[model samples]
Target: MTPPGPCPRPLSRALIVAEARRIADEEGLGSLTVRRVARRLGTGQASLYRHITDRGQLLSLLAGDVALRLPLCADRGDPRERLRDHWLAAHDHLARHLWAARVIADGEHAVGTAAAFADGALGALAEAGLDPDDAARAHRVLWNLLLGHLLNAHPVGRTGTPRRHGDGSRSDFSWALSRVLDGVLAGQPAGGRWRLGR
Candidate 1:
C-alpha cells in the first residue's frame, strides 16, 4: 500500500515544542501528556516519541526554552536594580507559564534556563563585591522569595481578584517584590550595614 510514502513532511521539533508550551500555558502541566501532545499536534504518539523520549525530557526542554528568554545582564550596575529587573522578568515569565512553575516547584522538572540565570545573577552579585558563596546564596534566596511571593499573591483559579493594575489600582505584586528586594539589598554587606543595626 505504498508504505506511507516517506510521510510527506517531517514534523518540526520547534513546532512541537511551541505547541507543547502553548498547551501547558493554556491547560497547565498536569494536562500535558504524550497522548495530549500528539493530539494537539495532530500526529501519532509514536511520532512524538521519536523526538521526545518521555514527559521528563519534554518538561526539561520546555523549562530550558523558557529560561533562555530570561534577561540576564552583566553590566556591574546597581545590584538592587539588576536584581529587581531580573526578578521582575522572571515573575513575568513564570506568570506566562504557570504550569511550568508548578511542575518545576513540584520537582518534576529541571530548568536549564534557571541554572543559567542563577549563574549570571551570582556572577553579577560577585562583581558587585559580594562574596562568591554569598552571591550564590543571595541569588537562591531572592529567587525563592520571589517565587513564593508570586505564587502566594496570585493563586491559581481565583478569578474574583484583579490580575493587573491601572492608574488608581494597588500594585500588590510590585509592592511585594519591592519589599523583598529591599530586604535583600539591606542584608547585603556592601550597602546593607543598616541591616546589622536592626
Candidate 2:
C-alpha cells in the first residue's frame, strides 16, 4: 500500500482544524493532541505549527468551530420554547464534544459563533420581557446549568453510552433540563425556591 502523502501546504490549516475536530468528537477531547493530529494527517509537527500555534490555540479553534456549527435562527416561539431549543442545541453540541464544556467554562476565548449564540439567547430572554440585566442573568443561569449537566451526563471514556433512566434511576438529565427551562421562564433560578422579594 502506498504510504499516505503529506498534507499539502495550502490546505494545512483547514485540514488540521478538521482533523482536530474529528479527534475530539470520536475519541473525546482529552485524547486530542498535536502529535496525534500531525500523525493522523501524515505531516510533521512543524507543518502544523505553521497554521496552529499550540494545543491551547487548537482547542480554542475547536471550541469556535463547534460554536459555528450551531444553526442560527430567528426567534419563533415563546421564550420558554426558545430557551429550551437553545439549551438542547447547546447540550447536544457539548455532548458531542465533551471537552468543549471545560474550555467554554474556563472563559479561555471568545469566538463569533459563541457570541452569536449568546445574542440569540439574550434576545429571546429580553423579548420575553426581561430587562438587559435580567436577560444577562438568565443567560448565565442557562449556561451554568448546561455546563454542569453536560459534565455529569458525559463522563470521560464513557462517550456514546446511553443514559440509564428506566428501573428507578435517580438521575434524569432530561427531566432536570425541562425543569430548569421552566424555572427560567417562570422568573426563577434553576435551584432556588420562589421568593416574594427580589
Candidate 3:
C-alpha cells in the first residue's frame, strides 16, 4: 500500500480564519465562536487561541478581509460622481456580505481594510474643496447611510442577505446618494465650507 501521506500540518491562523469565516457565512456572525470553529476543525477549543487572540479579533479580521474586496474610487473623475460611485459600490459590496456590515457595526474593523477607499474619498472631497472637518463629517454620514440601508433591507425569511425591492436596491441607493451629495455639496464657496439649516 502506498505510504500514508505526511501527517497533516498543524492548525494555522489562515486555516482558523477560513473556518471561522465559513461559520460566519453559513450560520451567522454570532455563531463564530472559538469552540464552534474548533469543533468544526476537529481541534480543541484552546488550540484556536494559538491562532487568534479572541473572537473580537476574529470578527475584525473577517471585516477587514471583506472590506479589501470593495471597490476603490477612481483616481480622476468628477468629485461628486466619484463619491457617489464609491458609496454605491460599497453599498453593493455590503449587501453581498450582509454579515460584514454587522461586524463593522459591532466594531470599527472595516477601517483598516478600507484605508485605500477612505483615502480616495477624502482626496476626492478635498479636490471638491471640502475642508478636512467637513469631509470627515460627510464620510461618517455616508457610512451610516450605507450601513443602515443594507441592514434595513428586509430579509427573505431573515436569511443572511438583503432582499431587493421593486426596481432594485441599487437604484434606490443611487437615488438617495444623489440627494445626500447635493445637500452635502450645496452652499459651498471657493474654500468649500458648507452649512445646513438645522
Candidate 4:
C-alpha cells in the first residue's frame, strides 16, 4: 500500500485574522502583511494565501472584525440627533483600528456587521425624508468625509491609545455633521417614518 502524504494543517482563518489584527493594533495597519503574519504564525506565506486572497482581503477581514463590535442603530430621538449619534459612534469605533476605516471606506467590504451598520445609516437617512437614491448618495458622501477625517486625524505608523470623544473633537464633528445635514435635509423635517431602498 502507498504511504499517505503529509497531513495539512486545518484552515484556521480566524487565527490568522486574530494575529493580523494584533500586528495592526500594535504597530499599525501598514505593518500588517502576509509575510509578517506567516512569519509570526511560523508558517509559509503561501499557506496564508490559501486562506486570504491578498493583503486587501485581509484588511477587509480586519474591518469585519471591528465592525462586529461597532455600535450602530441609535435609540429613538430627534432623527437628526439620532443620525448624528450613529456617525459619531462609528467614527469612534473606526478610530481605534489603524486601517479598518480605510478598508471599509471602499464601501464594498460589506461584511456581516459592516453591512448592518450601513443599513442602519441608510435607514436613518430614509427616515429623515430622503429617497432611496438620495439616501445612498448621502451615506456615501458621509462615509467619504468620515474616512478622510480618520485617515488624516491620525498619522501613519501611529499606535497605542485609541481616540476618545473629547469635547473639542465632539464639538467639531458635530458642527461638520450639522452642516451636511442642513444641506441634505433642507426643507425636510426629520422622523418621516420612511424605509431605506424602498
Candidate 5:
C-alpha cells in the first residue's frame, strides 16, 4: 500500500493565519514559516500551500491581520487631536507585536487594513488644510516616524528597553508625535511642505 497522505481534516486560511500569528508573537516573524506553521498545525508544509502560496503571501496576510487592529478615526473631532489618536493607536498596537514594525516597513506588502487607515488619515490631513499631495507626504512622514520609533524601541527576538540611546518612554513618544504634528500645523498653507529649521 502507498504511504498515507496528510490527514484529510479540513483547514481554513484563518486557522493557518492564526497559527502563523501565534508563532510570530512567540518567536518573532523571522521564526514564522510554512514548515513551522505546518508543524504547529500537525500537518505537512505541502498542505499549507492550499491556503497560502508561500511565506511571502503568508506574511502579507499576517500584515493585513495586524492592520485590522488599527483604530479608525472618528467622524468629528479637532483634526489635530483625531490624527494624534489615530497614530497613537497604531503605535500602541504595532508595539505589542515584536515583529510587526519590520513587517509593516515592507511597503510592497501593504494590504486592505493599512490602505484603509492611510486613506482615512490622508483624508483627515487634507481636511486639516494640507493639499492632496502634501497630505499624502505628511501621512508618509508620520507613519515612518511611528514605525522607526517602534522598530527601535522593540527589536526582533528581544525584550525590555530598546538597545539604543535616548529616552524611549511613552512620554518621549508623545513629545515626538506632538512635534511632528506641530510641524504639520505650522506648514498649514495648502500645497506647502513642512520642514524643520534649516
Candidate 6:
C-alpha cells in the first residue's frame, strides 16, 4: 500500500532555514545536505528543493537569516562604548554560530543583512571623528580582528567550556577593543597635519 501524506500543514521556507541552521550548529556545515535537512524536518528532499534551489542557496539564506539576528547599534552612551558593545555582540554571535563565521570568511556576503552591520559599524566610527576612508578601513580591520581572535581562541574539535584570555580578571575583549579605538583616534590629523602621538 502507498504511504500516508505528510501530516497536515506543510512546512514553510522559514522552518526549513531554521532546521538547516540547527543542523549546521549541531553537526557542522559539512553535514548540511538537502537529504539531511529533509530528514530533520520530517519531509522529503523534493519538498526542501521547492524552497531552496540547492545547498549553496540554502546556506546563503541561512547565513543571512542568522546575520539579521545580530544586534544593531543599540544605545549605551558614548560612541566608543556603543562600538565596543556592537563588536562584542557580533563576536558572541559568530562564536556561537561558527559555521556562519566560516561562510563569511569564505566571502559570502548576505547583502541586506550583512550590509546593515557594516553600515552601522562604519557610521559609528565616522561619528567618532574618523574620516570616510579611515572609517571604512577601520570597520574592515575591526571585523577581521574580531573574527581572527574568536576563531583562534575557540578552535574547532576542542571540547569543554570556552575560555576568554586576559590578565588578572580583565577581559581581553575590552583591552583589545580599547587599544584598537585608541590607535584609530591617534591616527586622526592634529592641527591639520597627521600626528602619530599626542
Query: Model 1, 37-114: lDDT tens per residue?
Result: 777666788998888898887888887787777677555667666666777777776777766555666666666666
RMSD (Å) of each candidate, 1 decimal: 6.1, 6.3, 6.4, 8.0, 7.0, 6.0
lDDT of 5 at 160: 72
lDDT, residue 4, model 4 = 29
**Which segments of candidate 5 are over 4 A away from where they belong?**
1-9, 153-169, 187-198
Report the C-alpha displacement of residue 8, candidate 1, in angstroms.
9.6
Give per-residue CA lDDT, model 4, range 1-198, as digits (tens).
Answer: 443243245647898898899899789877888988887777778988888899888888887889887778775677777888888887787766747766776676767867878888898888888889999999998887777666666434435565543324545566788899889888676556545454
Candidate 6 lDDT: 0.74
- Go through the candidates in order and give each one's C-alpha lDDT: 0.67, 0.72, 0.76, 0.76, 0.78, 0.74
Task: Assess every candidate by TM-score.
Answer: 0.74, 0.76, 0.74, 0.70, 0.78, 0.78
**Model 6: residue 26 alpha-carbon error in angstroms:** 1.2
Q: Candidate 2: which stretches are off by over 4 Å?
A: 1-5, 153-171, 187-198
User: What local lDDT does model 3 show for residue 29?
Assistant: 80
Worst 10 residues of 5 by lDDT: 189-198
lDDT of 3 by residue, 1-198 (tens): 343342256788878877777788778787778888877777777888887999888888778778787889887767787788889888887777778887788775645778887888887787666889988888888888887776665655444445553226677678888898889888654333244551
For TM-score, candidate 1 versus 6, the one ahead is 6
Looking at candidate 5, what is the lDDT of residue 54? 95
Best of the candidates, lDDT: 5
Task: For model 5, name the residue pairs that clash.
Answer: none
Q: Tell me how far the alpha carbon of residue 91 in candidate 4 is from the true structure, in angstroms, after superposition.
A: 0.5
Better of 4 and 5 by TM-score: 5
Reference-based lDDT, residue 14, model 6: 89
Query: Compared with the true structure, what per-residue lDDT tens digits does model 5 show for residues 22-134?
Result: 99988987789899888877788988998899999999999899998777876576778778888887777776775877887867687677677888788779767787887
The TM-score of predicted model 6 comes to 0.78
